[model samples]
Target chain A: MRLVRQLFTVTGLILLSAGYAHADDIKLVNQAFKEVAVVNAKGEKEFKLVEPGTVVPKDEILYITTFANTGDQPATDIVITNPLPNNSRYKAGSAFGAGTEISYSVDGGKSYGTPETLKVSGSAGQTRAAGPDDYTHIRWVYTGELAPGAESTVTFRTIIK
Target chain B: MAGRGYKQILSRLAAVLLLGYMDSSFALGTAANTVINNTAVVDYQVAGVPNAVNASVAFTIEELLDVNVVSLDAANVSVVSPSSGRQLTFLLTNTGNGSEQFLLSVDTALAGDNFDPVPASARIWIDANGDNTLDTLNDILYNGTNGPVLDGSTPGNDAVAVFVLADIPAGRTAGELANVSLIATSVIADAAGEVNNVGAEITAGGDGGVDANIGVSGAQSSAIGTFEVVNSGVSIAKSVLVFDTQGGQDPHPGAVLRYTLQVTVSGASSIDNLVITDSVPANTTYVANSIVLDGVSQTDAGDAPGVDFSDFNISNANTVTVDLSQGGNITVVPPASFTIGFEVTID
Candidate 1:
C-alpha cells in the first residue's frame, strides 16, 4: 500500500507537469505591494513596497509581479492577465512595463480595450465611459520575445475604495 | 487499496472545497475600515503552453470620523424689518478619527419659538479664505438649488466657516420672536438622520456601519437662531440746582434755580419726531440759551438754521419746548444722549 501511494504521488506530479508542460520553464516570481507616500515637502508621492499584512484604505497601492523565462529557448507572445483586487479601483494611466501594450477589462476579463475605448453599462441601461471603479482586469502583452534567463516586471496602481 | 484511495480522494475533495470557499468569501469586497483579502491571478503563455498562477494580500481599511460645530456668535438678534440675508456665523470642525462629508439644512419652523408666517429660505456659506468676512472674494454660498458638500477633518484638522442665513418677514411686531435652526448631518449615514452614537464595525456582524460627526453630541447637530423685535424708545432723568447771593444755602424766595434734563435714546432702530417740553415752575423766569443738546447750547429760536433744532419755542415765558426733528431732517437716534439746562427764579 505504501509503494502504491508513492507511485500514485509520482504519477500525479508527472500528469500535472504534462498538463502545464511549459509552466515550470516560465516562472511567476514573488508578488509585492507598494504604497504611495509624500515623504518630502514638495507634495510629491514616493512609492514604497510594503510587506504582507499591511493596512491600507483610500490610498494608492502599486501591485508588482515579476516573471522570468528559465528555459533554454526564447518565449514568444507572453501575455499576463491580472484582475484588479476587490474593494480597489484602478489608477488611471498607472500601468508600467517595458515593451508591453497595456489594456483593461471592464467585464471580468471578458473584453479588453484602452481606457477611452472601454464602456460600461449604467443603471438606466445606457453605456457610458468606463471609470476606474468599473475596471475588472489589467493585461500586459509583451511585444518582443523574451530570451532564456530573461526576467520582466509589470506594475499597476489601484486605490483602495 | 480501495479504502486508501477513497480516503485520499475524500481528503483532496475537502481541500479543494475549502480553497474554493476561501476564494469566494475573502476575495469579495468588504465594508470600510475592515480587513479585506484580495488575490490576483496571472495567466501567461510560455512556448505555446498556457499557464496560470495566483497570489493574495490582505489589508485593513482606515476608518475614523469626528466632527463638531462651534457655537454661533449671536443666539438672539433683533431686527425691525423682515429682510433677507440675516446672517449668523459659526465654525464647523471635524473632530473624528477620519475625514468625512457633512450635509447642511435649516429648520425655520423649529419648535419653541415663533415661526415665520412664511418659512424663510435657509442657506450656508464657507469662509473660503478664513477672513471670517462674507464678501465677493472670500464667501462661497451653499444653497438648496445646488447643495453643498462640506469636507471634514481627514488629511488634517479642518475648521470650516458656516453661515446660517434667513429672511425675516415684514410686519414683525415688537416682542414677537422667531426661531431658525441649522442642522448638520453626516452624508455617510445610512439614512438622512442624526448619528449621535458610535457606529458598529462591519465585521462585527449586522449591516450597520460607522459615520462621521456633525458637530453635535450625537449624529445630528442643530443650532437655534432667535430673532426678537423690540421697541425701545427713550429714557429721561431730571435734577435741580439752586443759586443765590448767599450761595443758596436754602431754597429762599430770591434764590435762583437751575433745572437739567438728561435725555437718552434706546433700542436697535432709529427713531423720528423726538420732542421735549417743560412747563416753567411758578414765579420762575426762563433763561435764554440755557438748553443744550449733547453739550451744544440752544436758543429759543424756532426754525433757525444751525440752532440744533427745527423749532425751539418758549410760549408766554412759562412754557419751554424743544423740537429735535429739523424739518424732517434731524432726529435723536439710538446710542445718543443730550442734556438741557435752564435757570429760573423762585418767587
Candidate 2:
C-alpha cells in the first residue's frame, strides 16, 4: 500500500507540470505555393495557387504562415519573424496580414522598420532607403490579442534568383 | 541519408564536368539541385509569459535544358572545282544547366544557293584539338552515331568546335556558291517537343538523376556554312610612271616610261615555271640595264646559275622576260604577289 501511494503521488506531480508547460500554447505552420494560369468553368483565365513541383529561375513563390493560440488564455503581443530564403528576392508590397503592422529588416534581422524608414548601406558605404531586394527578413506584429483557439495567417511572395 | 549521398555524388559529377572548360561566366542563376530552405517563427505572450513556435519548408531547383549553335567561319569557304577536302568551321554550345550529348547532322541541299555540295561527300567532324582547323588525323569524324558531349553546368566548358567538309562537283564554275548547314539536336528523349515548355519536368533525366526542365533554346540549333568556287590563277595590275624630258607626266619622244607590274597569285595551287614576258611598246626603245624584279636589279643577259633569271631580247627582240620560278627550281604558291619594273624610252 505504501508503494502504490508513492506511485500515485509521482503521477500527480507529472500531470501538474504538464499542465504548467501547456500555458504558452501557440502552433505555427508554414507552406509554399506557386501560381499557375488556368481557365475556370466560365472560360475565364485566372491564376490559381498550387504546389510548386518544378521551379526555375525567375519563378515566383508564395509563402504563408499560419499561427493558432491553442492555450486556454488569450495570447498577447503576437509577433512573427521570417528570414527570406537564399537564391531568392522579395517581391515588393507582397506581405499581407489583417490588423497587423508589417516591417522589414536589412541588417540581418538586427533592426526592423517600415519600408520608407529602413536604410541599407550600398557597396560604396552610402546609406540609402532600403528596397525590396535589400530585405533580408520580414516581421509582423499583431495589433490585437489573440483569443484562445483563434487562428490567423500572414503571407509574402518572393522570386527565385 | 540516401538522398544526401545522392546529392553529394551529383555535386561531384558537376565538378568533373566543370573541368572540361577553363572559363565560365554564362550560367543563368542558381545551380540545379540547389536546396532553398525557408523557416518562419512566431513569438507571443500567453498570460504575460513569452513563448515561441517555428515551422520550415524546403525544395530543390530543377535543371534547364538549352543549346546554341553558330557558324565559326567568318565568310564563305573558298574552294575549287572538282576539289576534295574543303572544310567549314562551326561552334556548338550547350546553353542549358546540365551536361548533355548531341546528335549531329548536315544538310547540303539548302535553298537559295548557286549549287549544292555533293551529298555523298559531305561529312562532319569535331575539332578535337580545339585549333578550329579540320585535322583529319587528329579530329574525330561524325559517323551518324558518335556526337559531342558538352557540359552546360558551367560557362566555359559548354562550347565545342565543329567542322563540315564536302567535295566540289567537277562541273561547278567559278563564283558559284554551295551552302551547308550543321544541326545539333539534344539526345534526351522527347526533348524536341518539350522545348520552351517552362516548368515541364522530366523525372531523373538531368545530370546525376536530377529532374530537368526545358529552357528557351528548345534544345535544338543549326547554322549554315557556305562554300564558294574560286578560280586558282594569277592576276596583274600594271601602272606606268613616265619621266618626260621636262619631268612632266607625258609619253613624248625621248621621255622614259617606267612600267610597274604588280603580280598576284590567287587560289590554292602553286605554279611551276612561272615565266613572265612583256613586249616593248611600238615606238618605245628598250632601256638597257633597267630590268628589276621585286625591287632588285636583274642583269640584262641570258639565264645563268647565279647571275639572274631575267634578260632582255633573249626570247624575242624588243621583249623582256623574268623567270620567277628560276628555271623550274621553285614552286610559286597562290595568294602570293611579286612586283617587276622596267623602263623603256619613247622612240
Per-candidate DockQ vs. reference: 0.13, 0.28
**Tens-digit lDDT string for candidate 1 (B162-268):** 77777777777777887766666555542534366553322311112332222224545666667776555777798998887697547787777888889877556
Fnat of candidates, each listed: 0.29, 0.64
Please report how far candidate 1 places residue B17 from its true position, in Å. Answer: 43
Each prediction's number of clashing residue pairs? 11, 1
Candidate 2 regions exceeding 4 Å error are A1-24, A40-43, A72-77, A91-135, A141-152, B1-26, B128-139, B171-175, B190-201, B230-233, B239-253, B258-342
Assess candidate 1 and give its TM-score to the true structure. 0.40
CAPRI category for model 2: acceptable
Q: List the residue pairs that clash in candidate 2.
A: B24-B156
Error of 1 at B208 (Å): 15
Largest DockQ belongs to which candidate? 2
